[model samples]
Target: MQNVTVVDHPLVQHKLTIMRDKETSIAGFRVLLREIAHLLCYEVTRDLELEMISIKTPLETIEAPTLKGKKLVFASILRAGNGLLDGMLDLVPAARVAHIGIYRDHETLQPVEYYFKAPADIADRLVIVVDPMLATANSAIAAIERLKQRGANNLRFLCLLAAPEGVQKFNEAHPDVPVFTAAIDSHLNEKGYIVPGLGDAGDRMYGTR
Candidate 1:
Protein backbone atom coordinates (compact mmCIF):
# COMPACT_ATOMS: atom_id res chain seq x y z
CA MET A 1 0.00 0.00 0.00
CA GLN A 2 1.32 3.41 -0.89
CA ASN A 3 1.76 5.76 2.04
CA VAL A 4 1.53 9.52 2.25
CA THR A 5 4.47 11.37 3.78
CA VAL A 6 3.90 13.01 7.15
CA VAL A 7 6.56 15.69 7.40
CA ASP A 8 8.21 15.64 10.86
CA HIS A 9 10.16 18.84 10.65
CA PRO A 10 10.11 20.64 14.00
CA LEU A 11 8.99 23.91 12.42
CA VAL A 12 6.15 22.18 10.59
CA GLN A 13 5.07 20.22 13.68
CA HIS A 14 5.17 23.29 15.92
CA LYS A 15 3.18 25.50 13.58
CA LEU A 16 0.65 22.72 12.95
CA THR A 17 0.11 22.27 16.68
CA ILE A 18 -0.63 25.93 17.14
CA MET A 19 -2.98 25.97 14.18
CA ARG A 20 -4.84 22.96 15.54
CA ASP A 21 -5.70 24.70 18.78
CA LYS A 22 -9.24 26.07 18.85
CA GLU A 23 -8.10 29.11 20.81
CA THR A 24 -5.86 30.21 17.97
CA SER A 25 -7.40 33.36 16.45
CA ILE A 26 -8.13 33.75 12.77
CA ALA A 27 -5.14 36.03 12.30
CA GLY A 28 -2.94 33.52 14.03
CA PHE A 29 -4.42 30.68 12.06
CA ARG A 30 -3.82 32.39 8.74
CA VAL A 31 -0.27 33.32 9.64
CA LEU A 32 0.63 29.90 10.90
CA LEU A 33 -1.02 28.21 7.94
CA ARG A 34 1.15 30.20 5.53
CA GLU A 35 4.26 29.57 7.58
CA ILE A 36 3.64 25.83 7.67
CA ALA A 37 2.89 25.82 3.94
CA HIS A 38 6.27 27.38 3.23
CA LEU A 39 8.00 24.75 5.36
CA LEU A 40 6.09 21.93 3.71
CA CYS A 41 6.78 23.30 0.23
CA TYR A 42 10.48 23.19 1.02
CA GLU A 43 10.30 19.45 1.58
CA VAL A 44 7.98 18.70 -1.30
CA THR A 45 10.17 20.46 -3.84
CA ARG A 46 13.42 18.97 -2.63
CA ASP A 47 13.54 16.48 -5.49
CA LEU A 48 12.73 18.91 -8.29
CA GLU A 49 14.97 18.30 -11.24
CA LEU A 50 17.84 20.71 -11.69
CA GLU A 51 20.16 21.47 -14.62
CA MET A 52 23.55 23.01 -14.64
CA ILE A 53 24.14 26.21 -16.61
CA SER A 54 27.20 28.32 -17.23
CA ILE A 55 27.01 31.78 -15.75
CA LYS A 56 29.44 34.68 -15.51
CA THR A 57 30.09 35.78 -11.95
CA PRO A 58 31.53 39.12 -10.92
CA LEU A 59 34.93 37.55 -10.26
CA GLU A 60 34.87 34.68 -12.74
CA THR A 61 32.65 32.41 -14.84
CA ILE A 62 31.14 29.40 -13.16
CA GLU A 63 28.51 26.72 -13.59
CA ALA A 64 25.36 26.87 -11.46
CA PRO A 65 22.44 24.47 -11.08
CA THR A 66 19.09 26.01 -11.95
CA LEU A 67 15.60 24.64 -12.33
CA LYS A 68 14.93 23.29 -15.80
CA GLY A 69 11.89 23.64 -18.07
CA LYS A 70 8.75 25.59 -17.31
CA LYS A 71 8.00 26.77 -13.77
CA LEU A 72 5.57 24.71 -11.69
CA VAL A 73 1.90 25.44 -11.71
CA PHE A 74 0.66 25.74 -8.14
CA ALA A 75 -3.03 24.91 -8.24
CA SER A 76 -4.80 25.97 -5.07
CA ILE A 77 -8.00 24.16 -4.16
CA LEU A 78 -9.63 27.45 -3.45
CA ARG A 79 -10.17 29.51 -0.29
CA ALA A 80 -8.07 27.53 2.14
CA GLY A 81 -5.62 26.58 -0.56
CA ASN A 82 -4.93 30.26 -0.98
CA GLY A 83 -3.26 30.25 2.43
CA LEU A 84 -0.82 27.64 1.23
CA LEU A 85 -0.34 29.51 -2.03
CA ASP A 86 0.94 32.63 -0.27
CA GLY A 87 3.75 30.75 1.40
CA MET A 88 4.67 28.70 -1.65
CA LEU A 89 4.85 31.81 -3.79
CA ASP A 90 7.28 33.30 -1.33
CA LEU A 91 9.58 30.39 -2.10
CA VAL A 92 8.96 30.26 -5.87
CA PRO A 93 7.70 33.64 -6.87
CA ALA A 94 7.93 32.81 -10.56
CA ALA A 95 5.60 29.85 -10.41
CA ARG A 96 2.15 30.33 -11.91
CA VAL A 97 -1.06 29.70 -9.96
CA ALA A 98 -4.33 28.06 -10.86
CA HIS A 99 -7.53 28.00 -8.82
CA ILE A 100 -9.98 25.14 -8.41
CA GLY A 101 -13.07 25.28 -6.22
CA ILE A 102 -14.74 22.22 -4.78
CA TYR A 103 -17.32 21.95 -2.02
CA ARG A 104 -18.83 18.92 -0.35
CA ASP A 105 -22.46 18.22 -0.99
CA HIS A 106 -24.17 18.13 2.38
CA GLU A 107 -26.74 15.55 1.26
CA THR A 108 -24.61 13.23 -0.87
CA LEU A 109 -21.25 13.88 0.79
CA GLN A 110 -19.67 14.02 -2.65
CA PRO A 111 -17.48 16.71 -4.08
CA VAL A 112 -19.08 19.37 -6.27
CA GLU A 113 -16.94 21.44 -8.52
CA TYR A 114 -17.80 25.11 -8.67
CA TYR A 115 -14.76 26.50 -10.48
CA PHE A 116 -11.78 25.19 -12.42
CA LYS A 117 -9.05 27.03 -14.26
CA ALA A 118 -5.47 26.30 -15.18
CA PRO A 119 -2.71 27.23 -17.53
CA ALA A 120 -3.18 26.19 -21.12
CA ASP A 121 0.24 24.55 -21.08
CA ILE A 122 -0.46 22.47 -17.99
CA ALA A 123 0.86 19.34 -19.67
CA ASP A 124 4.39 20.68 -19.74
CA ARG A 125 4.47 22.08 -16.24
CA LEU A 126 4.82 20.35 -12.91
CA VAL A 127 1.41 20.77 -11.30
CA ILE A 128 1.07 20.81 -7.52
CA VAL A 129 -2.52 20.74 -6.26
CA VAL A 130 -2.80 22.07 -2.73
CA ASP A 131 -5.38 22.10 0.06
CA PRO A 132 -5.16 22.45 3.81
CA MET A 133 -6.81 19.14 4.68
CA LEU A 134 -7.32 15.80 2.97
CA ALA A 135 -10.42 14.32 4.59
CA THR A 136 -12.51 12.01 2.41
CA ALA A 137 -10.22 12.53 -0.61
CA ASN A 138 -13.22 13.47 -2.73
CA SER A 139 -12.17 17.04 -3.42
CA ALA A 140 -8.53 16.23 -4.01
CA ILE A 141 -9.41 13.35 -6.29
CA ALA A 142 -11.92 15.43 -8.19
CA ALA A 143 -9.42 18.23 -8.57
CA ILE A 144 -6.78 15.86 -9.92
CA GLU A 145 -9.24 14.29 -12.29
CA ARG A 146 -10.06 17.68 -13.66
CA LEU A 147 -6.40 18.50 -14.04
CA LYS A 148 -5.77 15.24 -15.84
CA GLN A 149 -8.67 15.87 -18.11
CA ARG A 150 -7.11 19.21 -18.91
CA GLY A 151 -3.83 17.46 -19.82
CA ALA A 152 -1.88 17.75 -16.60
CA ASN A 153 0.10 14.53 -16.34
CA ASN A 154 2.99 15.35 -14.03
CA LEU A 155 1.21 16.17 -10.81
CA ARG A 156 1.49 16.11 -7.01
CA PHE A 157 -0.82 16.76 -4.05
CA LEU A 158 0.13 18.83 -1.03
CA CYS A 159 -1.84 19.26 2.18
CA LEU A 160 -1.29 20.43 5.71
CA LEU A 161 -3.03 17.40 7.23
CA ALA A 162 -4.51 14.13 6.06
CA ALA A 163 -6.46 11.18 7.47
CA PRO A 164 -5.39 7.58 7.00
CA GLU A 165 -8.66 6.67 5.34
CA GLY A 166 -8.34 9.58 2.95
CA VAL A 167 -4.75 8.74 2.14
CA GLN A 168 -5.67 5.18 1.33
CA LYS A 169 -8.57 6.25 -0.81
CA PHE A 170 -6.47 8.79 -2.66
CA ASN A 171 -3.67 6.34 -3.32
CA GLU A 172 -6.11 3.81 -4.62
CA ALA A 173 -7.85 6.35 -6.80
CA HIS A 174 -4.70 8.02 -8.13
CA PRO A 175 -1.52 6.23 -7.26
CA ASP A 176 0.44 8.00 -9.95
CA VAL A 177 0.56 11.19 -7.94
CA PRO A 178 2.33 11.18 -4.59
CA VAL A 179 0.84 13.05 -1.64
CA PHE A 180 2.72 15.12 0.94
CA THR A 181 1.26 16.28 4.23
CA ALA A 182 2.41 17.62 7.55
CA ALA A 183 0.64 14.83 9.47
CA ILE A 184 -1.70 11.92 8.92
CA ASP A 185 -4.30 11.61 11.64
CA SER A 186 -6.42 8.61 12.63
CA HIS A 187 -9.64 8.38 10.64
CA LEU A 188 -12.48 10.38 9.25
CA ASN A 189 -15.86 10.93 10.90
CA GLU A 190 -19.03 9.62 9.26
CA LYS A 191 -19.65 13.13 7.96
CA GLY A 192 -16.38 12.98 5.99
CA TYR A 193 -14.37 15.24 8.25
CA ILE A 194 -10.99 14.18 9.53
CA VAL A 195 -10.96 13.54 13.29
CA PRO A 196 -9.30 16.43 15.15
CA GLY A 197 -8.64 18.10 11.80
CA LEU A 198 -8.41 21.63 13.14
CA GLY A 199 -12.05 22.13 12.24
CA ASP A 200 -13.36 23.18 8.81
CA ALA A 201 -10.33 24.57 7.00
CA GLY A 202 -12.28 27.01 4.86
CA ASP A 203 -14.19 28.32 7.84
CA ARG A 204 -11.14 28.52 10.05
CA MET A 205 -9.14 30.39 7.45
CA TYR A 206 -11.90 32.80 6.53
CA GLY A 207 -13.38 33.34 10.02
CA THR A 208 -16.67 31.90 8.86
CA ARG A 209 -19.02 29.71 10.93
Candidate 2:
Protein backbone atom coordinates (compact mmCIF):
# COMPACT_ATOMS: atom_id res chain seq x y z
CA MET A 1 0.00 0.00 0.00
CA GLN A 2 3.04 2.28 -0.11
CA ASN A 3 2.36 3.70 -3.56
CA VAL A 4 -1.23 2.56 -3.81
CA THR A 5 -4.51 4.17 -2.75
CA VAL A 6 -7.62 2.18 -1.96
CA VAL A 7 -10.74 4.28 -2.53
CA ASP A 8 -12.79 2.99 0.40
CA HIS A 9 -15.65 5.42 0.42
CA PRO A 10 -18.96 3.88 1.42
CA LEU A 11 -20.38 4.39 -2.03
CA VAL A 12 -17.32 2.95 -3.70
CA GLN A 13 -17.30 -0.07 -1.38
CA HIS A 14 -21.01 -0.69 -1.90
CA LYS A 15 -20.72 -0.51 -5.66
CA LEU A 16 -17.69 -2.81 -5.62
CA THR A 17 -19.62 -5.36 -3.62
CA ILE A 18 -22.29 -5.38 -6.28
CA MET A 19 -19.68 -5.89 -8.96
CA ARG A 20 -18.25 -8.84 -7.04
CA ASP A 21 -21.53 -10.65 -6.70
CA LYS A 22 -21.99 -13.43 -9.25
CA GLU A 23 -25.73 -13.09 -9.08
CA THR A 24 -25.62 -9.50 -10.30
CA SER A 25 -26.89 -9.02 -13.84
CA ILE A 26 -24.65 -7.71 -16.62
CA ALA A 27 -26.59 -4.46 -16.90
CA GLY A 28 -26.27 -3.94 -13.17
CA PHE A 29 -22.54 -4.60 -13.24
CA ARG A 30 -21.95 -2.10 -16.02
CA VAL A 31 -23.90 0.56 -14.25
CA LEU A 32 -21.98 0.04 -11.04
CA LEU A 33 -18.66 0.19 -12.84
CA ARG A 34 -19.56 3.56 -14.29
CA GLU A 35 -20.80 4.86 -10.97
CA ILE A 36 -17.69 3.70 -9.12
CA ALA A 37 -15.44 5.23 -11.76
CA HIS A 38 -17.01 8.59 -11.02
CA LEU A 39 -15.92 8.26 -7.39
CA LEU A 40 -12.43 7.06 -8.24
CA CYS A 41 -12.01 9.92 -10.67
CA TYR A 42 -12.60 12.33 -7.85
CA GLU A 43 -9.82 10.83 -5.71
CA VAL A 44 -7.32 10.50 -8.56
CA THR A 45 -7.67 14.13 -9.64
CA ARG A 46 -7.62 15.74 -6.22
CA ASP A 47 -4.20 17.31 -6.72
CA LEU A 48 -4.69 19.00 -10.06
CA GLU A 49 -3.09 22.41 -10.11
CA LEU A 50 -5.34 25.46 -9.98
CA GLU A 51 -4.66 29.04 -11.09
CA MET A 52 -6.57 32.14 -10.24
CA ILE A 53 -8.07 34.11 -13.11
CA SER A 54 -10.21 37.21 -13.35
CA ILE A 55 -13.89 36.39 -13.77
CA LYS A 56 -17.15 38.30 -13.45
CA THR A 57 -19.47 36.83 -10.81
CA PRO A 58 -22.83 38.60 -11.47
CA LEU A 59 -21.94 41.90 -9.83
CA GLU A 60 -18.16 42.23 -9.68
CA THR A 61 -15.07 40.82 -11.34
CA ILE A 62 -13.08 38.54 -9.04
CA GLU A 63 -10.23 36.15 -9.39
CA ALA A 64 -11.56 32.66 -9.84
CA PRO A 65 -9.54 29.48 -9.47
CA THR A 66 -9.42 27.25 -12.52
CA LEU A 67 -7.47 24.22 -13.62
CA LYS A 68 -4.09 24.97 -15.13
CA GLY A 69 -2.15 23.35 -17.97
CA LYS A 70 -3.44 20.96 -20.62
CA LYS A 71 -6.39 18.62 -20.24
CA LEU A 72 -5.76 15.12 -18.89
CA VAL A 73 -5.57 12.03 -21.07
CA PHE A 74 -7.24 8.79 -20.02
CA ALA A 75 -5.42 5.88 -21.58
CA SER A 76 -7.40 2.67 -21.69
CA ILE A 77 -5.52 -0.62 -21.71
CA LEU A 78 -7.55 -2.52 -24.21
CA ARG A 79 -11.01 -4.12 -23.83
CA ALA A 80 -11.37 -4.20 -20.05
CA GLY A 81 -9.83 -0.78 -19.74
CA ASN A 82 -12.71 0.56 -21.81
CA GLY A 83 -15.12 -0.40 -19.02
CA LEU A 84 -13.59 2.31 -16.82
CA LEU A 85 -13.33 4.89 -19.61
CA ASP A 86 -16.95 5.96 -19.90
CA GLY A 87 -17.29 6.72 -16.18
CA MET A 88 -14.02 8.62 -16.05
CA LEU A 89 -15.12 10.52 -19.12
CA ASP A 90 -18.38 11.35 -17.43
CA LEU A 91 -16.31 13.00 -14.69
CA VAL A 92 -13.72 14.64 -16.96
CA PRO A 93 -15.67 15.44 -20.06
CA ALA A 94 -12.89 17.45 -21.67
CA ALA A 95 -10.15 14.92 -21.08
CA ARG A 96 -8.51 13.30 -24.07
CA VAL A 97 -8.48 9.53 -24.58
CA ALA A 98 -6.03 6.93 -25.76
CA HIS A 99 -6.51 3.24 -26.42
CA ILE A 100 -3.91 0.55 -26.05
CA GLY A 101 -4.85 -2.97 -27.05
CA ILE A 102 -2.78 -5.61 -25.33
CA TYR A 103 -3.76 -9.23 -25.09
CA ARG A 104 -2.22 -11.78 -22.79
CA ASP A 105 -0.62 -14.82 -24.33
CA HIS A 106 -2.36 -17.72 -22.68
CA GLU A 107 0.64 -20.02 -22.94
CA THR A 108 3.21 -17.60 -21.55
CA LEU A 109 0.96 -15.15 -19.71
CA GLN A 110 2.93 -12.28 -21.25
CA PRO A 111 1.43 -9.11 -22.69
CA VAL A 112 1.45 -8.57 -26.43
CA GLU A 113 0.31 -5.34 -27.94
CA TYR A 114 -1.74 -5.40 -31.10
CA TYR A 115 -2.80 -1.78 -31.30
CA PHE A 116 -1.91 1.56 -29.74
CA LYS A 117 -3.16 5.08 -30.41
CA ALA A 118 -2.71 8.23 -28.35
CA PRO A 119 -3.37 11.89 -28.57
CA ALA A 120 -0.72 14.24 -29.84
CA ASP A 121 1.27 16.32 -27.33
CA ILE A 122 0.88 13.65 -24.65
CA ALA A 123 4.19 14.74 -23.13
CA ASP A 124 2.64 17.98 -21.97
CA ARG A 125 -0.40 16.45 -20.33
CA LEU A 126 -1.27 14.27 -17.36
CA VAL A 127 -2.07 10.74 -18.52
CA ILE A 128 -4.10 8.33 -16.39
CA VAL A 129 -4.06 4.70 -17.54
CA VAL A 130 -7.08 2.59 -16.72
CA ASP A 131 -7.87 -1.12 -16.50
CA PRO A 132 -10.55 -2.85 -14.44
CA MET A 133 -8.35 -5.58 -13.01
CA LEU A 134 -4.68 -5.59 -12.13
CA ALA A 135 -4.11 -9.28 -11.65
CA THR A 136 -0.66 -9.96 -13.09
CA ALA A 137 0.52 -6.40 -13.83
CA ASN A 138 1.96 -7.61 -17.13
CA SER A 139 -0.56 -5.67 -19.23
CA ALA A 140 -0.31 -2.59 -17.06
CA ILE A 141 3.49 -2.57 -17.17
CA ALA A 142 3.51 -3.10 -20.90
CA ALA A 143 0.91 -0.42 -21.47
CA ILE A 144 2.86 2.07 -19.37
CA GLU A 145 6.02 1.21 -21.25
CA ARG A 146 4.22 1.93 -24.50
CA LEU A 147 2.90 5.22 -23.20
CA LYS A 148 6.35 6.34 -22.09
CA GLN A 149 7.68 5.49 -25.48
CA ARG A 150 5.15 7.93 -26.87
CA GLY A 151 6.59 10.68 -24.58
CA ALA A 152 4.04 10.48 -21.78
CA ASN A 153 5.83 11.21 -18.48
CA ASN A 154 3.32 12.41 -15.95
CA LEU A 155 1.23 9.31 -15.45
CA ARG A 156 -1.03 7.48 -12.98
CA PHE A 157 -2.66 4.05 -12.98
CA LEU A 158 -6.30 3.49 -11.98
CA CYS A 159 -8.17 0.25 -11.68
CA LEU A 160 -11.21 -1.28 -10.00
CA LEU A 161 -9.42 -4.19 -8.30
CA ALA A 162 -5.77 -4.94 -7.63
CA ALA A 163 -3.86 -7.95 -6.38
CA PRO A 164 -0.87 -7.68 -4.05
CA GLU A 165 1.48 -9.41 -6.46
CA GLY A 166 0.35 -7.15 -9.29
CA VAL A 167 0.79 -4.05 -7.16
CA GLN A 168 4.29 -5.08 -6.08
CA LYS A 169 5.35 -5.74 -9.63
CA PHE A 170 3.72 -2.60 -10.98
CA ASN A 171 5.32 -0.41 -8.31
CA GLU A 172 8.71 -1.93 -8.91
CA ALA A 173 8.31 -1.41 -12.62
CA HIS A 174 6.92 2.12 -12.42
CA PRO A 175 7.24 3.56 -8.95
CA ASP A 176 6.62 7.08 -10.15
CA VAL A 177 3.17 6.08 -11.39
CA PRO A 178 0.92 5.95 -8.33
CA VAL A 179 -1.93 3.43 -8.31
CA PHE A 180 -5.56 4.06 -7.39
CA THR A 181 -8.02 1.23 -6.91
CA ALA A 182 -11.34 0.61 -5.22
CA ALA A 183 -10.15 -2.59 -3.54
CA ILE A 184 -7.11 -4.77 -3.06
CA ASP A 185 -8.27 -8.35 -3.08
CA SER A 186 -6.67 -11.14 -1.06
CA HIS A 187 -4.50 -12.63 -3.80
CA LEU A 188 -4.49 -14.11 -7.27
CA ASN A 189 -5.74 -17.63 -7.89
CA GLU A 190 -3.85 -20.24 -9.92
CA LYS A 191 -4.86 -18.81 -13.28
CA GLY A 192 -4.00 -15.21 -12.34
CA TYR A 193 -7.52 -14.44 -11.25
CA ILE A 194 -7.95 -12.36 -8.11
CA VAL A 195 -9.59 -14.42 -5.40
CA PRO A 196 -13.01 -13.09 -4.49
CA GLY A 197 -12.69 -10.74 -7.44
CA LEU A 198 -15.58 -9.65 -9.58
CA GLY A 199 -14.62 -12.32 -12.06
CA ASP A 200 -13.62 -11.30 -15.61
CA ALA A 201 -14.56 -7.68 -15.54
CA GLY A 202 -14.72 -7.36 -19.30
CA ASP A 203 -16.89 -10.41 -19.61
CA ARG A 204 -19.16 -9.30 -16.84
CA MET A 205 -19.46 -5.79 -18.14
CA TYR A 206 -20.16 -6.72 -21.73
CA GLY A 207 -21.87 -10.11 -21.22
CA THR A 208 -19.06 -11.75 -23.12
CA ARG A 209 -17.23 -14.95 -22.27
Candidate 3:
Protein backbone atom coordinates (compact mmCIF):
# COMPACT_ATOMS: atom_id res chain seq x y z
CA MET A 1 0.00 0.00 0.00
CA GLN A 2 3.03 2.27 0.09
CA ASN A 3 2.64 3.58 -3.41
CA VAL A 4 -1.11 3.24 -3.65
CA THR A 5 -3.81 5.88 -3.33
CA VAL A 6 -7.44 4.80 -3.08
CA VAL A 7 -10.14 7.23 -4.17
CA ASP A 8 -12.79 7.08 -1.44
CA HIS A 9 -14.90 10.04 -2.41
CA PRO A 10 -18.62 9.58 -1.72
CA LEU A 11 -19.60 10.06 -5.35
CA VAL A 12 -17.01 7.52 -6.47
CA GLN A 13 -18.16 4.96 -3.92
CA HIS A 14 -21.80 5.48 -4.83
CA LYS A 15 -21.13 5.05 -8.52
CA LEU A 16 -19.01 1.94 -7.94
CA THR A 17 -21.81 0.32 -5.95
CA ILE A 18 -24.16 0.69 -8.90
CA MET A 19 -21.53 -0.69 -11.25
CA ARG A 20 -21.17 -3.77 -9.04
CA ASP A 21 -24.80 -4.70 -9.32
CA LYS A 22 -25.40 -7.60 -11.72
CA GLU A 23 -28.73 -6.19 -12.87
CA THR A 24 -27.28 -2.86 -14.05
CA SER A 25 -27.76 -2.46 -17.78
CA ILE A 26 -24.76 -2.32 -20.10
CA ALA A 27 -25.46 1.33 -20.91
CA GLY A 28 -25.63 2.18 -17.21
CA PHE A 29 -22.39 0.38 -16.50
CA ARG A 30 -20.56 2.19 -19.28
CA VAL A 31 -21.83 5.58 -18.16
CA LEU A 32 -20.82 5.06 -14.53
CA LEU A 33 -17.34 3.92 -15.51
CA ARG A 34 -16.79 7.12 -17.45
CA GLU A 35 -18.19 9.26 -14.67
CA ILE A 36 -15.95 7.55 -12.09
CA ALA A 37 -12.93 7.88 -14.35
CA HIS A 38 -13.25 11.66 -14.14
CA LEU A 39 -13.03 11.59 -10.36
CA LEU A 40 -10.10 9.16 -10.43
CA CYS A 41 -8.30 11.34 -12.94
CA TYR A 42 -8.68 14.31 -10.64
CA GLU A 43 -7.01 12.50 -7.72
CA VAL A 44 -4.26 10.83 -9.74
CA THR A 45 -3.03 14.07 -11.23
CA ARG A 46 -3.42 16.07 -8.04
CA ASP A 47 0.25 16.94 -7.62
CA LEU A 48 1.26 17.53 -11.20
CA GLU A 49 3.68 20.39 -11.35
CA LEU A 50 2.61 23.82 -12.54
CA GLU A 51 4.48 26.90 -13.70
CA MET A 52 3.54 30.51 -14.11
CA ILE A 53 2.85 32.00 -17.53
CA SER A 54 1.82 35.47 -18.65
CA ILE A 55 -1.84 35.89 -19.63
CA LYS A 56 -4.01 38.81 -20.55
CA THR A 57 -7.22 39.58 -18.69
CA PRO A 58 -9.83 42.29 -19.04
CA LEU A 59 -7.91 44.43 -16.55
CA GLU A 60 -4.27 43.58 -17.36
CA THR A 61 -1.72 40.91 -18.25
CA ILE A 62 -0.64 38.75 -15.30
CA GLU A 63 1.17 35.54 -14.58
CA ALA A 64 -1.14 32.54 -14.59
CA PRO A 65 -0.41 28.93 -13.67
CA THR A 66 -0.15 26.29 -16.35
CA LEU A 67 0.94 22.66 -16.46
CA LYS A 68 4.73 22.56 -16.47
CA GLY A 69 5.73 19.63 -18.63
CA LYS A 70 4.71 17.97 -21.85
CA LYS A 71 1.16 16.71 -22.16
CA LEU A 72 0.57 13.52 -20.15
CA VAL A 73 0.34 10.26 -22.04
CA PHE A 74 -2.36 7.74 -21.12
CA ALA A 75 -1.38 4.15 -21.92
CA SER A 76 -4.55 2.13 -22.09
CA ILE A 77 -4.27 -1.66 -21.89
CA LEU A 78 -6.44 -3.29 -24.50
CA ARG A 79 -10.27 -3.55 -24.54
CA ALA A 80 -11.21 -2.90 -20.93
CA GLY A 81 -8.75 -0.10 -20.49
CA ASN A 82 -10.59 1.88 -23.12
CA GLY A 83 -13.57 2.19 -20.78
CA LEU A 84 -11.52 4.20 -18.30
CA LEU A 85 -9.69 6.00 -21.09
CA ASP A 86 -12.92 7.52 -22.37
CA GLY A 87 -13.53 9.21 -19.04
CA MET A 88 -9.92 10.21 -18.47
CA LEU A 89 -9.96 11.89 -21.88
CA ASP A 90 -13.09 13.78 -20.97
CA LEU A 91 -11.04 15.50 -18.27
CA VAL A 92 -7.67 15.85 -19.97
CA PRO A 93 -8.66 16.50 -23.54
CA ALA A 94 -5.08 17.20 -24.68
CA ALA A 95 -3.41 14.15 -23.17
CA ARG A 96 -1.74 11.81 -25.62
CA VAL A 97 -2.96 8.19 -25.84
CA ALA A 98 -1.31 4.81 -26.28
CA HIS A 99 -3.28 1.67 -26.96
CA ILE A 100 -1.52 -1.52 -25.96
CA GLY A 101 -3.16 -4.68 -27.17
CA ILE A 102 -2.42 -7.52 -24.80
CA TYR A 103 -4.63 -10.20 -23.37
CA ARG A 104 -4.27 -12.90 -20.77
CA ASP A 105 -3.90 -16.43 -22.03
CA HIS A 106 -6.57 -17.99 -19.83
CA GLU A 107 -4.70 -21.27 -19.53
CA THR A 108 -1.32 -19.97 -18.45
CA LEU A 109 -2.57 -16.68 -17.08
CA GLN A 110 0.17 -15.02 -19.09
CA PRO A 111 -0.02 -12.01 -21.36
CA VAL A 112 0.13 -11.97 -25.15
CA GLU A 113 0.91 -8.83 -27.05
CA TYR A 114 -0.78 -8.28 -30.39
CA TYR A 115 -0.64 -4.53 -31.08
CA PHE A 116 0.81 -1.29 -29.81
CA LYS A 117 0.49 2.33 -30.95
CA ALA A 118 1.50 5.57 -29.32
CA PRO A 119 2.97 9.01 -29.88
CA ALA A 120 6.55 9.14 -31.15
CA ASP A 121 7.63 11.43 -28.33
CA ILE A 122 6.48 9.08 -25.58
CA ALA A 123 9.83 9.42 -23.86
CA ASP A 124 9.17 13.05 -23.05
CA ARG A 125 5.81 12.69 -21.37
CA LEU A 126 4.48 11.25 -18.13
CA VAL A 127 2.72 8.00 -18.97
CA ILE A 128 -0.29 6.92 -16.93
CA VAL A 129 -1.29 3.33 -17.68
CA VAL A 130 -5.01 2.54 -17.39
CA ASP A 131 -6.68 -0.81 -17.02
CA PRO A 132 -10.02 -1.77 -15.45
CA MET A 133 -8.72 -4.65 -13.36
CA LEU A 134 -5.36 -5.78 -12.07
CA ALA A 135 -5.92 -9.35 -10.97
CA THR A 136 -2.79 -11.18 -12.10
CA ALA A 137 -1.01 -7.99 -13.07
CA ASN A 138 0.62 -9.85 -15.94
CA SER A 139 -1.02 -7.76 -18.65
CA ALA A 140 -0.37 -4.48 -16.87
CA ILE A 141 3.23 -5.49 -16.21
CA ALA A 142 3.78 -6.56 -19.80
CA ALA A 143 2.19 -3.39 -21.14
CA ILE A 144 4.39 -1.16 -19.01
CA GLU A 145 7.50 -3.10 -20.03
CA ARG A 146 6.62 -2.56 -23.69
CA LEU A 147 6.22 1.16 -23.14
CA LYS A 148 9.52 1.34 -21.27
CA GLN A 149 11.15 -0.39 -24.20
CA ARG A 150 9.99 2.55 -26.26
CA GLY A 151 11.69 4.97 -23.80
CA ALA A 152 9.04 5.99 -21.29
CA ASN A 153 10.64 6.65 -17.90
CA ASN A 154 8.06 8.49 -15.85
CA LEU A 155 5.00 6.34 -15.40
CA ARG A 156 1.96 5.58 -13.21
CA PHE A 157 -0.62 2.77 -13.19
CA LEU A 158 -4.33 3.42 -12.71
CA CYS A 159 -7.01 0.80 -12.39
CA LEU A 160 -10.60 0.50 -11.22
CA LEU A 161 -9.91 -2.55 -9.06
CA ALA A 162 -6.75 -4.31 -7.89
CA ALA A 163 -6.13 -7.52 -6.04
CA PRO A 164 -3.49 -7.54 -3.32
CA GLU A 165 -1.60 -10.25 -5.17
CA GLY A 166 -1.53 -8.18 -8.31
CA VAL A 167 -0.47 -5.07 -6.43
CA GLN A 168 2.40 -6.89 -4.77
CA LYS A 169 3.57 -8.28 -8.08
CA PHE A 170 3.24 -4.92 -9.81
CA ASN A 171 5.18 -3.10 -7.10
CA GLU A 172 7.88 -5.73 -7.18
CA ALA A 173 8.08 -5.46 -10.97
CA HIS A 174 7.90 -1.67 -11.29
CA PRO A 175 8.43 0.00 -7.97
CA ASP A 176 8.84 3.47 -9.38
CA VAL A 177 5.34 3.73 -10.77
CA PRO A 178 2.61 4.61 -8.30
CA VAL A 179 -0.84 3.00 -8.47
CA PHE A 180 -4.18 4.79 -8.27
CA THR A 181 -7.25 2.64 -7.93
CA ALA A 182 -10.87 2.99 -6.94
CA ALA A 183 -10.77 -0.12 -4.76
CA ILE A 184 -8.56 -3.04 -3.78
CA ASP A 185 -10.77 -6.07 -3.51
CA SER A 186 -10.32 -9.08 -1.19
CA HIS A 187 -8.24 -11.28 -3.49
CA LEU A 188 -8.02 -12.92 -6.89
CA ASN A 189 -10.27 -15.82 -7.76
CA GLU A 190 -8.96 -19.09 -9.27
CA LYS A 191 -9.42 -17.84 -12.84
CA GLY A 192 -7.46 -14.66 -12.12
CA TYR A 193 -10.44 -12.45 -11.54
CA ILE A 194 -10.71 -10.08 -8.59
CA VAL A 195 -13.03 -11.33 -5.90
CA PRO A 196 -16.05 -9.09 -5.34
CA GLY A 197 -15.15 -7.15 -8.46
CA LEU A 198 -18.01 -5.82 -10.58
CA GLY A 199 -17.39 -8.79 -12.88
CA ASP A 200 -15.43 -8.78 -16.18
CA ALA A 201 -15.11 -5.13 -17.08
CA GLY A 202 -14.81 -5.75 -20.80
CA ASP A 203 -17.84 -8.01 -20.74
CA ARG A 204 -19.86 -5.48 -18.78
CA MET A 205 -18.82 -2.56 -20.92
CA TYR A 206 -19.51 -4.27 -24.26
CA GLY A 207 -22.22 -6.82 -23.42
CA THR A 208 -19.76 -9.54 -24.42
CA ARG A 209 -20.92 -11.83 -21.64
Clashes of each: 0, 0, 0
Quote the RMSD, in angstroms, for model 1.
1.0
Which residue runs does candidate 3 get wrong by more than 4 Å? Answer: none
For this target, which candidate reaches the highest lDDT against the unseen true structure? 3
Which portions of model 1 show Cα errors greater than 4 Å?
Answer: none
TM-score of 3: 0.98
The sequence of per-residue lDDT tens digits that candidate 2 reaches over residues 1-209 is 89999999999999898789999999999899999999999999999999999999889999999999999999999898887999999989999999999988867879999999999899999999999999999999999999999999999999999999999999999999999999999999888889889899998988998
Model 1 lDDT tens row, 46-144: 899999999999999999999988999999998789999999999999999999998888778799999998999999999999999999889899999
Q: Rank order by lDDT, top first?
A: 3, 2, 1
lDDT of 1 at 117: 84
Q: Which lDDT value does model 1 have at 134?
A: 93
TM-score per candidate, chains pooled: 0.97, 0.98, 0.98
Error of 2 at 113 (Å): 0.6
Ten residues in a row with the worst lDDT in model 1? 1-10
**After superposition, candidate 2 runs with Cα above 4 Å error:** none
lDDT, candidates in the order shown? 0.91, 0.94, 0.95
